[model samples]
Target: MTDIPPLPETLQFTADGLIPAIAQQFDTGEVLMMAWMNKNSLAETLATGRICYWSRSRRSLWRKGDTSGHIQKLIELRYDCDADSILVLVDQSGAACHEGTRSCFTRRLEIDGSISEAETAYPTKIDESARQ
Candidate 1:
């Protein structure tokens, strides 16, 4: 069995003592989104079993799935081999994007490198009406 990794002893937080965390879906293994996290937010997230983020624009901590009910149930938190990045795998509920998309990765890129937003991954939600 894969044991849960312990929080690193030499974790290198930024000058502001914050780190960026990338969240992905555990089942589909698709990358979902990225967010910032401070030490306090990290601690609280593990302690409370909730995915928390450091909101740079708001300069505060926010628990995912709090506002829009798009909560990420923590499946695992992983550290890169270099210990510089964190990956969070989760069972996400509702839309993962603030734009009300199921994932932030709703755009499709052609083999020729052209890009286009296919459509909303999520069909209904608050941001939907606002977008239309």
Candidate 2:
């Protein structure tokens, strides 16, 4: 196994000390979701091998799938060259979006200025408990 690199101190968080994190399916290359992460959440994810993010609404660390059972297991973590954004390759279980969709990007904007639903490989697995 290759040694994982430590989180670089050069990461550029926003004024609120948060960085945008994009989660993608490691094998399929499907983008699952995008969320925010503070330093603490990022550290926890790296240490635990599970996906975690900073919840702006809750003002705390949000562990993905903790309530919904749609956990994202970390396969790999990467930062952009600018060190302002993050990419997390993961093994996702169930839905990755709060709406119980496989991905948050289930819609597309047409060239003619209309919106359409994009085709998803998997059906949505709605979890009612996730809403709470």
Candidate 3:
């Protein structure tokens, strides 16, 4: 694997020292989730080749899928033109959402100012055999 480039010094972080990061499926182009990251978490993700995010509510570093076994392997890291946001291309092992779905973006905003849950073609369902 190629080494990740060093974090640019020109990155513009928020006043709270955080930046928004969006995770996308590397091959399929599915948007998984968006999270916050700080300098430390960003560095950790690069070094480990796994996605790491900052938990604002918990006030700590959150390694993706640490407890759920839904790890996100980093394929590439990118930054937007604004330098204030990041996009993480990853190979997701399982459900990226804590809700046990492949992605967190299941809700869609309709043009009529209504919100709807997108239909799931292959919803993640618990396999009873796996518990055996």
Candidate 4:
């Protein structure tokens, strides 16, 4: 079994004790979404090998698939040189967005300033049980 590392004490957080974490597809490099992580949430994710984030609005830890069922299985975890941000490489199952989209970045902003859908952008149907 791979050894799970502890949360780094040198990691940086915002004044509110939150760090930005970007989730991406491990093999495809497709960015799924960005979320905030507190120390507790980060620790839990490291321990469980499942993605977890701090829900600022809910004031609680948000496990990626607990509600949506579009789980993000951790493949690798990385931190920027600054140690202020995180990049979570994952094998995402089903739609990663709560809106049932494959990625939260499905919309593209054109050079002309008009918003356009990405070439392969289509939302997968989420299970009814997954809806809030």
lDDT of 4 by residue, 1-132 (tens): 135457788899999999999999998888889999998888878888898899999999899999878899888999999999999999999988887888898887664799888633445456888566
Please report, as a residue range, the 10-residue window in candidate 3 with the lowest summed lDDT. 118-127
Error of 1 at 94 (Å): 0.9
Model 1: residue 117 alpha-carbon error in angstroms: 1.8
Consecutive 10-residue window with the lowest summed lDDT within model 4: 118-127
Comparing 2 and 4 on TM-score, the stronger one: 2
lDDT of each: 0.79, 0.89, 0.88, 0.86
Name the candidate, 3 or 4, with the larger TM-score value: 4
Alpha-carbon TM-score of each model against the true structure:
0.78, 0.85, 0.83, 0.84
> Of the candidates shown, which would achieve the greatest lDDT relative to the real structure?
2
Global lDDT of model 4: 0.86
Candidate 1's residue-wise lDDT over 1-132, tens digit each? 123335667667889888889988898877788888877777777776678899899998898977888898888888777666788888899888998887887887654799878564333235655556
Task: Report the error of model 2 at residue 59, Å.
Answer: 0.6
As for lDDT, the candidate ahead, 1 or 4, is 4
lDDT tens per residue, model 2, 22-131: 99999998988999999888988988899989999999999999999999999999999999999999999999999888999888766588988866534455588855
| Clash tally, candidates in order | 2, 0, 0, 0
Q: How much does each candidate deviate from the true structure in C-alpha RMSD?
A: 9.3, 9.6, 9.8, 9.8
Best by TM-score: 2
Full ranking by lDDT = 2, 3, 4, 1
**Candidates ranked by TM-score:** 2, 4, 3, 1
